[model samples]
Structures are given as C-alpha cells and as structure tokens.
Target: MSNVKNTVIVITGASSGIGAASAIKLASLGGKVVLAARNEEKLKALVAEIRNAGGEASYFVTNVTDKTSLVGLVEFAIKQYGRIDSLVNNAGLMLFSDWKDVVVDDWEKMIDTNIKGYLYAIAAALPQMLEQGHGKILNMSSVAGLHVGGSSGVYSATKFFIRGITESLRKEVGVDSGVQVSMISPGVIDTGWADKVSDAKGREAAKALNEIAITPEQVADAVAYALDQPTNLTINDIVIHPTKQDW
Candidate 1:
C-alpha cells in the first residue's frame, strides 16, 4: 500500500454517505482532503471537523452536474493544495422506477447526475492528473452495474455505463499516463441515496433492502484501501455487499 500522507484527495458528493466518510477517513490518514458538494453548510461543517481533528482539509460548494462547477472544484483543490493526487467521483443519483411507470424525468435526472456528472468529473480532473504523470480516479459504481434488478433498470444502466467507462479509462491511462482508474461497486449501502427515489414502489423496495444494508463507513474504508495500494498495483474494481445481502 502507498502512503497517503500529504496527498491531496478531492471528494465530490461529500455532504453525506460514502463521500463524507471517505473524506474523514482519508484526512485521518494524513491526506489533505478537499470536500465538494452542493450543500455549503455541510461542507463547512465537515471541513471544520477535519481541521479540529488535526487533519488538513478544505471545501468547495459544487454541483457535479455542471461541468464548470467541477472545473472549479479541481481549481480549488489545486489552489489550496498545489497538487491533485486523487479524485473520488462519488457524486451520483439513483432514482429508480419500473420502466412501465415511464418516469422519464427521473430517467433524465439519473442520466444527468449519474452518467454525465461522472464524465464531467473525469473531464475536469484528467488533464491535471495526466500532466502530473501520477494520480488516481476512484469512481463510485454499484452492484446494480453488475446486474439489473427489479425497478432499477435505468439506474442500473447508468451504473453499468460507469463500470464500462472506468474500465476503459483504466486501460487508456494507467499504463501510459501513470493514472489509475478504479470503480467501487457497493450493494445496498445505507445512505441518503435511497431517499432520492421518487417512485412509491421503488422507495418501498429500497427500504426493505436497506434493512440489511451496509453502512457508508464500510464503503469509505474500501475507498481508503484502494487509494492505499502501491502506485504500480492498481485495484481496478471492487464489488462489496453486506454478508446477508443475497443480491
């Protein structure tokens, strides 16, 4: 495993869940964490908490859906820390509904936030990482990406796209540019993600699944573990789930 001390790691969707937990864990491991999320209040509070814990940290209010906003996030990290060692593209959406329900708006929202947002994060961070000759991009996928489930077809599609893109990106950048790309696919994690489900049936199913879900901190630990790997050894993909989760 590589040392994270003084490494500048940027995390998006950092207000809660895996992003927030990863920020705290990485900071504790001596990373200079830069938190980004749309919620300014939460970002400030998290930054303060990191600082109080004797870890270097900062934040930028960002909307990952906007390409320019992600650019600004990268800029903030560079301005504060002088280098971008890794970017955790954890901002995503998971609005689920049966295709028969035709939640077109929800589908568009998922496309914009989950797929496009993931692309924008890569677009914004890749240039600097390439120029530096060594960096990591850890993206958040899901077990849904591996297999389609009931009522989550569109959401699963987005994650599947992420999975393909992360794999392609790893091949494109890892050997030549010294940048490593990784994808974390978590199953039934307990987070605010399910709260975004608008369909009644989807929400009910999510509730039942979350009853046996793993905590966000567990996912965060996986993030830290991936980042801790030696530079030459890329942890390409990780699929984690609660032991009791059959799916």
Candidate 2:
C-alpha cells in the first residue's frame, strides 16, 4: 500500500455515508481531503472534526447535478492542495418505486443524481488528471447493478451505467496516463439512503433489511485499500455486502 501522506483526494457526497467515512479515514492517514456536497452545515462539521484531529481538510458546497458547481470543486481543490491525486465520486440516490407505480419526476431525479452526477464529476476532473498524467477515480456503485429486483428498476439501471462507464474508462485510459478507474459495489449498507423510500411497505422492508447492513466505515476501508495501491497497481472492481445478505 502506498502511504497516504501528501495525497490530495476530492470526495463528492462527503457529508455522510461512505463519502464522509472515506474523508475522515484518508485524512487520518495524512492525505489532504476536500469534502464536497450540497449540505453546507454537515460538510463544515466534518471538516472541523478532521481539523481537530490534526488532519488537513476543507469543505466546498457542491451540488453534483450542477456542472458549474463540480468545476468549482475541482478548482477549489487545485487552489488549496496544488494538485488533486484522486476523486471519489460517491454522491447518489436510491428511490424505491415499482415500475408500475414509478413517478416520472422521481425516476428522472434518480437518473440525474445517480448517473449524471458521476459523469459530471468525471468531466470536471479528467482534464486536470490528464494534465497531471496520474490520477485515481473511484465510483460508488451498488449490487443492484448486478441483479434486478423489485422496486429498484430505475435505481439499478443508473448503477449499471456506472459499472459500464467505469470499466470503459479503465480500458480507454489504460496505464498510459497513470490514471486508474474503479467501482465499488456495496450491498445493504446502513446509510440513511433507505429514508428516501416513501412507499409504506417498501419503506418498512428497507428499514428492516438495513438493520443488518454494513457500516459506511467498512466501505470506506475498501476505498482506502484501492487508493493505497501503488501507482502501478489497479483494483478494477470491489463488491462488498453484509455476510447475511443473500441477494
């Protein structure tokens, strides 16, 4: 594993879940971290916590859906840290709606935030990474991307796109630019993503299932493993799930 010292990492959705945990873990390992998300208060709190612990950190109010906001985030990181070594595109949403009852608005929101957000982040970071000739991009995917299930058609489709894009980028970039692209597919995570489930039965089921979900910190650890790899090494994909999860 490479030392985290002096590494500059930019993370989206850094206010909570895997993003927040990854920020803290990377900082603790001596990496300078930039936290980007729409929640200003939460981002500030996380930044303060890292600083108090003697780690370098900063916060930028970023809405991943907005391309300009993403551009600003990349610029902020460069201005603050000199160079960005990695980007964790972790912002996403999961809405529980059966295809029969799906609302077009909700479907669009899921597609935009879960899929387009990743693309925008890549679009903003790639130019800088290409110029640097070395970078790592970690994307947050879900097991739903691999398996189709009830009430997750649209959400799973978005994740499937994530998986495809990450793999395609990996091949396109190759080892020439020293850029590594990978995806982490987690199942049954204990994040508050289930809180977005509005259907009464689906909400209850999701809550019960999440009772056995893995902690966000666990996923963060996986991300740290990928980042810690030597420049010559690349982890193409990681699939993580609670041991008890059957599907």
Candidate 3:
C-alpha cells in the first residue's frame, strides 16, 4: 500500500468500532488523523493513545446529525493541518424493530443519523475537496443495504440510501475533479450495532452472528485500500464478509 504520510484524514464516529480502528491504523502509517464523535472522553482517550504511539492525532467532539457541527469538523481539520486528504463517514445508527411496532421517533432517528448524517459529512468535506481538486470520501455502508431480513427494513433502507448517495456523488464528481467516492459494505462486523436493536430476539440474533463476524480492523484495511489507490482509480463499491457468513 502507498504511504499516506502527511495526509490529513477525518473520521466520524471515531470513538469506537471501525472508526477508531481506522484512525489508529491510518495514523500508525504516518497520516494525521482527526477523530470526530460525540463521546468526548472516548475521543480524548483515543487521541492520547495514538499520540503516545508516535502518531499524529487530534479529536473533535462532534454530533454528525448536526450540520453545523460537521462543518466545524471539516474546518477544524483544514485549520489544524492545512488540508483534508480524506474523510471517512462512518457514524451510523442501526435500530431494529418490527415495521408494525416501530416507533416514529426511532425511525426518524435512524434516518437522521444513518442517512442524513452521512450526507452532511459529505457536504462538509466536498467543498474543500472541490477546491483542492483532489480528495477521497469513504462511506461506511453495510450488506444490509443490499438485502432484506426481518426487523431490518428501516435500517436496511438507510444503508441502501448510503449506497445510492455514494454512487450518485461519484458520478457527479466525475473524472476531472480528482475527488473519489467509495462505499464499503461489510457483513456481521463485530461492533456495538446490535445493541441498538429494540427487539430482544433480533438483538440476540445479531449478537450470535457477530460472534463469528469480521473484525473492525478488517474493514479499516479496506478503507485504507480505497484511499491508497491511485487518483485515477476509484473503487466504486467493496463488499466484505467473514468466511463463515453465508449471507
């Protein structure tokens, strides 16, 4: 893989899971990482861990659902490091409940956090990328985006929206812009996503599946793969699943 030394990377939801894993991995490779998330303590701890390991890192306590907060995150990166070479839109919500039993508030929360938040992050980063004429946007989608299952309709819809948005943005940016957009769709990642499920049975099922799930670092490696590609190369979509996962 190409060394991204001196590149500035911003990752949302960097307090934990794939976001945190990606930040550490990228920073370890000499990239300057700006971690964004709502959990200030977690973000601080992660920043210290990276810095202690001889990596360049910082933290921005941000709420992805807030447009202004996202803009601030982008601006902070530029002001702190002079440029943003990459953005990892990894903040998301996966609340699962039967369609009939789904609360409207819960549905809205999923839409706002999982879908709108992704869009806001792109909006925050795209302007700078366009001005620079070169950048990479890596969005975290899921296999749920491509398929349907019980109690996952709303969550799946949000991911499907992510895939569609990433594709549309990729085409819109086109060749001259030097702004590449890609989506990573992972199956049964060992994250805390299952904790969001409201249905006990669904939560248990997800936990059971994740028992043999792929590690967050695995997804992080895929993100680095997309980012390390030549400017002319855009990996439109990547779907990664554990060997034991049939779906």
By TM-score, who's the top model here?
Answer: 1
Residue ranges of candidate 1 with Cα displaced over 4 Å: none
Total backbone collisions for each predicted model: 0, 0, 0
**Rank by lDDT, descending?**
1, 2, 3
Best by lDDT: 1
Q: Give me the displacement of residue 168 in model 2, in angstroms.
A: 0.6
lDDT tens digits, residue span 3-120, model 2:
6678999999999999999999999988999999999999999999999999999999999999999999999999998889999999998877767775778788888899889999
Give the lDDT of residue 42 in candidate 2: 97
Error of 2 at 110 (Å): 1.0
Q: How far is candidate 2 from the true structure (C-alpha RMSD, Å)?
A: 1.1
Pitting candidate 1 against candidate 2, the one with the higher TM-score is 1
Mind giving the per-residue lDDT tens digits that candidate 3 earns over 33-140?
A: 999999999999999999999999998889999999999999899999999999999998877777777567778998999988998999999999999998999999
Q: After superposition, how far is residue 166 of candidate 3 from its true place, in Å?
A: 0.8
Q: What is the TM-score of each candidate against the true structure?
A: 0.98, 0.97, 0.96
